[model samples]
Target: MAGLFGSATLGIGGGTLSDLFRAQYRGKAVAIYSWSPILAPLVGAVLGGFISQNTTWRWTFYASSLLSIVIQLSGLIFLEVTYPPLLLRRKKARQAKATGADDLYTEYDHLDEGRVQVLSTNLFRPFKLLATQPIIQILALYNAYFYGNIYILYANYIDLWTNVYGEFIEIAGLNYIAIAIGSSIAAECCTLINYAIFRKLSSRNGGTGVPEFRVPIMLPATLFFK
Candidate 1:
């Protein structure tokens, strides 16, 4: 009933970006971090098309399973605990255990709530926000429209290339390279533009930081989407 796997994946990714990058570089770090997951599927589309054309489709599943296994093992072995609150809780528990103290605890230990409460809040948050905030509703609708068009393109791409353009399946997959290139360019451009705006805002605020600096970057993005 619950998506534990998806939750863990997002937690690890978001935690990694927060723990690994400085505040000034965080925007770029987040941009690059977000790019990988989307790029992987685009890359897979290109590879899958070629593989299915030349070899058995079974090989695609085989390769995917192998990659997933490797990533899982690597995560289990190599990933460090990046969440500060979790780390502090573990440290406090170790110290308390060593000292035989019942009262010693980390701040996070006291903030705990029932799992059901947490799940319910997270589940309802999107709907609540969409209902309450017109801006969020508009943004959600725009993103849904954009991604829906992308899915439509993915569905029809093979037919367009193979039937309309008279290209082979393997050759048709190369068309995805254009999408990949455009994504990379757009991501880099946005990263640079966002950082530039953030720097100016930070300067105008006498080097004090606020999240409002990030909102202007959306103007360019909205224009691009138009």
Candidate 2:
């Protein structure tokens, strides 16, 4: 999970969006990317409920494991490196290989920045940030609560519907329809409203943007969060 869609993918996606798109297109790109995390689990829960009901409950883990393996394998086969530092290092490597001299280097690959140093930095940076940055700590805590409740809800959702409502397992998955609809609407609102608010704020501030402009968008999110 960490290697695939957890912190690693979140970090990569944020960087990849900045690297791949201009500022004008970044918000829209980010909207789609951000919406994906919600969509995946909602879809997964519906499918998993049906799978568990007809087959053994253990099949849920097997199915998810298989899907994860397929996603990872596909990434290995088809994912392109969008990170500029990594891409630059690859180009430098190819050039050094062509010539006899193997002394090619970039600022990111300096003599002081060995593989061990880079690996350690990446491994511990999140923890360091979480400890040192108040904003990061708050965000981490909020997300812990947010996603923790969400996963717990999804985990118990099927049992709740089947037992309390006395619904058949096959149709119990249908209960998620309202959640799925609401989430879809929220995703669309995020894309449209965020972009509109940003543009409006930028215009109001003598054609410049302020971090304060982003705060209003968070107001709605915070109100709806719990």
Candidate 3:
């Protein structure tokens, strides 16, 4: 339960940071952030093996805790809210100072409904939409299948490396680097192709791009995943 909570918190915080970055910088941020899940476990297992060999297994938890503390301190010193509503509030204040308006405020400061009711509606709407929306249902089903395949691959990969290839722990860990590299290359290629397609479609459509123009790119990705 504690580990699950920590993972959720990290995911939320990382998402918040990504939202703070501009669109131009977001691709690089997301790429680096996505790399952590693949790299961390492999690096952790290598370190854990060495640590347990030399000292004790308990030190692993202690080392992780210390690292978390350092990260927390750094965040406290540097991190700030990047949500548009909050930034708009600050911007409004500055504009008020420059123009000396007494009634300066952002749209976020005014709510037509109560906050508690809004929160409750927002939380439940996703469930309602998922229940009724065909597109959402189909996508959810597809995502479940994709995740299941990934988990199965993760579970069986070690056996394939150790038994089939006769590799040791470090060598098996190195195999994951190939998966990471392949994924990175695939993502880069897809991004470039997407940009090209978007450009061509925009030119064809009188320099205007529509969301439907992007749907064709998903076909290739779906085929690759299959």
Candidate 4:
């Protein structure tokens, strides 16, 4: 259930960062944001191993639920509305209530053209990109393969160690820590490198930045070597 919702809305955080940050800093901000979802599962697996070995499997879920509650509470208290369209809509709503005006609207209100249109647009967007953009299709396929490998590893990793290598389950899970550490270091490097390259490219284009400027750094990073 968590995986279903997480995968469905994974793009929302990136979209939110795009709304909050300027173009020059947006890529770097999103890189930092992207690291969390990728790191969480890896780190969780390591913790799950120790918890499962010492306690029951149910305790692993209990720990997860407790941590999720903490995170949601923190977000409720500290997270502010950052998306401009949504912020404007919220402001308009408050003004309408206070002024007794039912006709108040925001610039983005045109987008609320019934639930059906909005749902269709959102649902078809990825397919539209895949249809029109060859690069997007290639990237999608590549990521599909890459994540497939990671999922397979997660399923068989402890079994391989505990059965073949005769390692304790707690020790077997420690291997995921190495992957988590490596990915963290890489994300930091990529964020800095991506920002630096974006700055240099934007400067060359008569002080105007193009989205294409992001592609060079992105391509190498896609290869996971940058």
Candidate 5:
């Protein structure tokens, strides 16, 4: 149940991040965010193995708890709301105070009624999109398959390393380095390709890039993932 709750929380976190971050920054941010999901188990295994070998298995839980506390403290200190609507609300309140005018305007203030309707629509929009939108349905199916393959690979990685390669626990954990290496290489390649493509498309489109410019890059990425 705890694991289920944690997964649910993570899904919410990812969705919130996607909602908050602009498309320009989201790719890099998501790539970095994704490293935690990939690295956590490998790090835990390494720490557990060291603790169990040097002292006791119980120390691993203590160490992880301490690290979690430190991370939570850091988040409390540094993280701030970056949503445009929230930021604009804060700005408007400050402006209203300074000018003594209650009629301060913000994009969010105009949407109070519409926002409620939009929220209601969003709640059921995913199912509607899947039923009506071919692009949405296809992309959803592709992403599901990709994520399923990734999970299967993760689940079998240790077996592949230990049984096939004859690695010890620590050595098996070290094999996660291959995942890190592949991720790093892919990141660099994608960054270069995306920048080049964006520049070309922007120039061709009279110096402005649209979301459509991103579509061409997705084909290669999908092919690579497959």
Candidate 6:
């Protein structure tokens, strides 16, 4: 359930950033946003092992709960409604209240009664793309393979280091630093390459972005991985 909620939050956050950012910066912003998930487990395993060994396993839950509370509070305090339709609807309501008129309505408020069906379709649209979109299918396949191996390694690292190397659990955890370092370097390199490709492609397209602009770089990168 925790992983499910966390993944859902990440998906929603990515969607929100897509809406919030301009086309040119969206790729870079998303790259940076996505770095956390790749990097966190590498860092967390070391720290979590250290804490669990020195203190108690319960502290992990406490720490996670505290961190969640802090983030939730910060979001509640610092974030504002960024969706344009929602903001406009709120403004319309305020205006109506002040002017004593019921006529004010945002475009969303005027949407058809069948909008519930439209919303349901929108919710299922991602699943539809997952099933049918070849590009999405390919990328999802690669991501699943890559992260699956990383997580498999994450789970078994302790056994590998402990039984094989006769290292303490905390010391065994230090092996995760190698994964963290490699991930950081790859992320930085990808960010730079992505930025360079996006700029060049945007210029070549006369400043209008084409989704295909991002594909060329990936081909070489994937081949290099091969």
List the global CA lDDT of all models.
Answer: 0.80, 0.79, 0.70, 0.83, 0.72, 0.81
TM-score, candidate 4, is 0.80
Would you list the rank order by TM-score, best first? 2, 6, 1, 4, 5, 3
Residue 106 of model 6, lDDT score: 74
Q: What's the true lDDT of residue 74 in model 5?
A: 93
> Which tens-of-lDDT digit does each residue in 10-50 have in candidate 4?
77777778788888778777777868976898889999999
> How does each model score on TM-score?
0.80, 0.83, 0.69, 0.80, 0.71, 0.82
Q: Which scores higher on lDDT, 5 or 6?
A: 6
**What digit string (tens of lDDT, one per residue) describes model 2 on residues 159-190?**
88889989987688877767777887887788
Name the best candidate (by TM-score). Answer: 2
Off by over 4 Å in 2: 1-5, 95-112, 203-213
Q: Residue 88, candidate 6: how far off, in angstroms?
A: 1.8
Root mean square deviation (Cα) for candidate 3? 4.3
User: What is the RMSD of candidate 4?
Assistant: 3.1
lDDT of 6 by residue, 1-226 (tens): 7886688777778778877998788877877776787787777788877888889999877877788799889989997767777678779989989999988777787653476898898789989999999989999999887778768878997889989989988899999999888877888788678877888889988998877877777777667766
Q: After best superposition, candidate 3 residue 186: deviation in angstroms?
A: 1.0
Q: By TM-score, is 4 or 5 better?
A: 4
Instruction: Tell me the alpha-carbon RMSD of every candidate.
Output: 3.2, 3.1, 4.3, 3.1, 4.4, 2.9
Worst 10 residues of 2 by lDDT: 1-10
Which consecutive 10 residues in model 5 have the weakest lDDT in total? 1-10
* Residue pairs in clash, model 1: none
lDDT per residue as tens, model 1, 16-124: 8878786677888877776775577678888888888889999888877788799889988997878777688788889888998888867787766688987899789
